[model samples]
Target: MNLKILTLDEFSRIDFINLVNKVFEDYTVPIKWDVVSFQLDVKENSISLSDSFVFLKDNIPFGFIVVSIRKEKARIDAMGVIKEERGTGAASYILEHTVNYLKWRGIRKIQLEVVKDDIRAYKFYEKHGFREKRLLYSMILKKTINQEINYRYFPVEPRTAYIQALEIYFNGRKPNWQREPISLLLSDNRYNFTKIVTNSGEGYLVWGKLEKENVPIIDIVAKNNYTDILKASINFLKSQTNCKNILISSVPEDDYLYQPLKKVSFQSILTQSEMEKEIF
Candidate 1:
């Protein structure tokens, strides 16, 4: 059984996509990515093909790891091996190699998220020196908000929203990788931005305009009056779209939006543990 590990760029885009779908076919949340979605993930997540790795067994793609780099920090955006290769030590080899490479490239830290209930995954990372940093939640709001919004909200440019988000993040707000400022900047054109100013404080909302029943609330930051800001934002989104539900993904439990999301009737559907390992 000959095994080889190569950078993701060594494979064609289609081959990489196929390997990803195959490796994650039975994941807790199975992901099927077409070319468009795959490309978008690469772009928005800062996935570096040259830094990522794909594992091959006898010339066949058997597993893969997607890495996203930002200066001295990196994230394991996704990683999985096929069921057949699970216990063959291939995962350990891939992770060790990837960590060494990141250290060699001067990366100081690496982070990833796993489903909170996935014991095997949690133990695997824990054994490999990764520790839980925080809890993240995927929330959804299905029921329509029937209350009136007293505060006024106005549409703004993506740049404006990003500036506010960055300030909030720098000022003690902890955002997950997906909701980081860079992620927002990379996918700016895909979302609509709005800001609300009231006597209490100010806030901004970033949401996607999709032609589906589920609309994504990408980022929401407020200096004060969080509950009211969230309510007004939801009311505004409801008025602007015909969506059936509002979805918010990977919100850190310690973030300012967490309690407000709960206060506004958003229910946590899935929870993930954000794990980190220092490579230095």
Candidate 2:
């Protein structure tokens, strides 16, 4: 089969969005076409249009790869091949082209995340020399409206400088790319940050609005003896907003807050593997 690859700019934004949404129609998370969201992702991850690509057969798009270049590192922000085009060597060809393209651009490392349950993708990356680095999780907490919050806390605006400083003493492993400090800083300013002080130390939580008035906790940090700080922060969030549930994503399994998150009624809803490859 004669295959052609096009730069992301080859198609208009709407056309490109349609192609991606079609290719990922069955993805674990539904992908929607929103210019604002797409632009935010590009800005947050420093994605360059030159590094993004689309694969075509007969001049029709069948696969695509979204890449973000950061100095010596490159990340596969997203990649997909249409369902009908799978098993035809299209994915392999696209991967090869993308890797070579990155290498030519002086990218020494490439990283991506695969849903743990996506056996095919997991094996595909492993077969292509990607090493599974760590487990990242999306956890959720649900509660009744009648429940009461006993702990007192207050909300504050999320500041990049403050988060950068707190990261120095943060005991948890770094989260996946999207939840990292840089991503948070690039995110819209609507997110709410909260702090809790206890005899032991100080803990912080960053949360944002979600559908149905739900609040998704973006990141949390607490000291060893201040695990209860997670509880207080949640209570503070509940008291401030009419959020019905709380969702947290990309939490490392080994993080100090992981166990405490579970104790606060958070349960794992999804899991992904952060994978990386070194290409000199």
By TM-score, who's the top model here?
1
Model 1: per-residue Cα lDDT over 1-280, one tens digit each: 7978888788888888887887787899777887888878888889999999888888988778899999999999988888888898878888998999999999999999999999999999999999999999999999666546576788887777778888888898878888887787887466777887655677888888755688889888777678888887787778778677899988898988999999888999999999999977
Model 2, position 165: C-alpha lDDT score: 30
Q: Model 2, stretches more than 4 Å misplaced?
A: 144-157, 160-166, 169-173, 222-226
lDDT of each: 0.85, 0.76
Best candidate per lDDT, number?
1
**In model 1, which runs have C-alpha deviations exceeding 4 angstroms?**
none
Q: What's model 2's TM-score?
A: 0.87
